[model samples]
Target: MSPERGRPPRRAVVRAARRGLGYMPGTLLIAAVAGVLGLSLGAGGVPDVVPAGGGLTVNDVTSKAFGQHAPGLPIGELRHFTIGNRLFNTNWVIAPASVRSLDGLGPYFNRVSCSACHVRDGRGRPPAGPEAPMMSMLVRLSVPGPDGTPAAHPIYGEQLSDRAVEGLAPEGRAAMTWEPLAPFVYADGSVVPLRRPRLDFVDMADGPLGPGAMTSARVANAVFGLGLLEAVSEAHVVARADPDDANGDGVSGRVNRVWDHDAQALALGRFGWKANQPTLRQQAAAAMAGDVGVTSEHFAGGNYTAAQTDAAALPNGADDEGVELSRKQLNRLTFYLQTLAVPARRDTHNPVVQRGEQLFGAAGCNACHTPVMQTGATAAHGVLVDQTFAPYTDLLLHDMGPGLADGRPDGLASGREWRTPALWGLGLQKRVSGHTFLLHDGRARNAQEAVLWHGGEARGARDRFARWPAEDRAALLAFLDSL
Candidate 1:
């Protein structure tokens, strides 16, 4: 049974109220008790808190929280998961290095390893300033092309690699200048500042980017619970698409149909900010080629474009198996990503969190950040199949308005469209990644800012959120924090 259906227990309510009003004096506690008894404690009364990931949720809520494997993964597979973990954290060096298994860092690439961007399997943050090196983020580049596909930059290709091997000139350095917009005032008289990012390229090996080049700034997202998401039936995801807002909810979510190299056919995209990759394995392969300049079966050659003559001359790792990463190695990395567990929600029973939960639905945040979903039987792993989870995302693309648009179309996703990111381990980002940046490009500094930046399909929810009273806002935030 769903926890929200029943009346909350008295002890749970009192505990939640105590936690919610922890800063308040003793008198406030008396008042809170009275309020609870009067049935006016929360927005619509105390709500029941469900387990965020149902059976798959882990209990840890610390710096290492995002690194756990899903509970009950078979012991035999656990060994494979460990092998995959090593591959995930392995730092690749330049070709002809002492470490043959980890060689082939880059002829031209952004980082040397997967962990460089997705630090600790958590989210990546934007650079602190224009002078700061991009440690955990990257810039995607493209130009207008024939058909639906966005064309890769002729010189820089699809991504700009700011770093390269010993002899090659890096593509260019990427920096950002932020232009602050006027502050927006909420109905409750709170002011929130917003900023837009403008990307700049300097020291280009191929001179300036094409005049028509379109760019998108992307931050690495948390890598947990992806297996469960991948496990969701394609039919289930497609069924959620309401591209025309047929229900009149003012929210239209659609799926991105992308090419699956493995299948050699068009398939539903389930990963990336624009939902551009159809499978986790494919996503890993693309990252290997694009970010680390390490080739896999999917991308057998180096990441160099034909124009990157200097980069093409660099030595690359090759074996009878085909590319830099063996199929075994790629399988291990995919397994690692697939088994990383979702952290269990914290403070779900807190009165403020409970109230916020009610307000979250009331404000229509649940429209795209759908709270519950059931995994189907098609999961690659038995552990991920037939599980009901609370990932808090519909995993469909929604038009996020001009404020968040990258002005770069990806697959079926428009410039203004972004896939609804899962919010399961959101509150733990600061602990895991050492920062609180949110959203695709890491522009929003916190959850509040993230919500404030929402527009287009989410404008209604954002407006409703702004209209909420201070206490209600606190409750809503508390609820999000608990998640």
Candidate 2:
């Protein structure tokens, strides 16, 4: 809640908080301060037993954009380069042209190049350069379990993938049609339509999608500050789960746990809808398999049929199906993803942008799309704590309405759940090679359409947005672009 929301004034909230913590022993006081700010004093910085909220306020939170970086990781100098050269021309090796070709592109692949999906290791939009929306991206799907529970992944033949490594096995295609609702009119008269996608995946005639034939529609989300977000302690995440909606806010925030088959244990999901993958290593490696049809240590084999896996054209890595992923490649991709920095926030001075930020909080967007958070330490990445980050997402999945459901379950995430995407790095849209295709499934032509599609738990917030004035509406869009 904002400091101004309570009946009490700013000073009163601060004062009451101070008195409430007055009895905390010195050790607890020091720990409390460290938990929130995580900053050190000068060279001799020792724990200050001072009361919390000495002068913190909304404005005070304005400059808090620098989140903690994983300590040991190198902060490479991001010297600029052309989009093709920096993102497309080379492979994950960062060598001159190590991984440039599509040699292992698929037994059921979406695109030929990593850059094909992720425009500049940045954001990708709909109709990415006039490509069909389905080619723009494909999601995973599966059928329900015997007990009628949602299935995260296809238990049998793959859920959805169009291309193949050797033209040897079952491949599926995804098609989408839009149903537009009535236009939304602001008090000042700007209109926007609320559209949802009814996706159809077909042509998997070679086999049946197993246990649960569910689908997860995904497009490349902005990759920024992944390492820092990874380093956040599980304790901090559990601290926020409100699955039962005990607060009566109509929003039930749930945490999803995933099975890291590679790690061989259940892990708290930190990526994908329902937090399906536990860490960047797992997510990146699996992408090597699903997105590129390349076998990795984690995925071990291509998403090919038994016959396709035996095809001579299969890559060196897939000789033995279901083998382990390449640990070396996993590390490299994880390194690249983790090192990607969050773009600086833009447009803070515009009145509309400022109002949007205010409304974002007022409408409870911040509760899920939290403006900031800190990271903790990890041996692989040190000094992750104390630094501040502005991811604009809590990395938790929320219950979006049926309009957005893909009917694919993974781990703890139901078909209707999706992770809150981070809004940082959004302003660079115009710089990439493609058009501004926003929203999952590339359905919303732009940011405005994206906002209007909100429903389910977000219905209240979307309704509030629908009733907003034109200037206020513009403010919200401005705030979103500022990310």
Q: Name the top lDDT candidate.
A: 1
The list of candidate 2 runs beyond 4 A from truth reads 1-104, 127-133, 147-159, 166-170, 187-189, 202-212, 305-315, 318-325
267-348: candidate 1 lDDT, tens digit per residue: 9998999999999999999999999989889998788899888878878876667688999999988988888888888877
Backbone clashes in model 1? 0
Instruction: List CA RMSD, all candidates.
Output: 6.9, 9.3
The candidate 2 region of ten consecutive residues with least summed lDDT is 51-60
Model 2 scores what on Cα lDDT? 0.57
lDDT of 1: 0.82
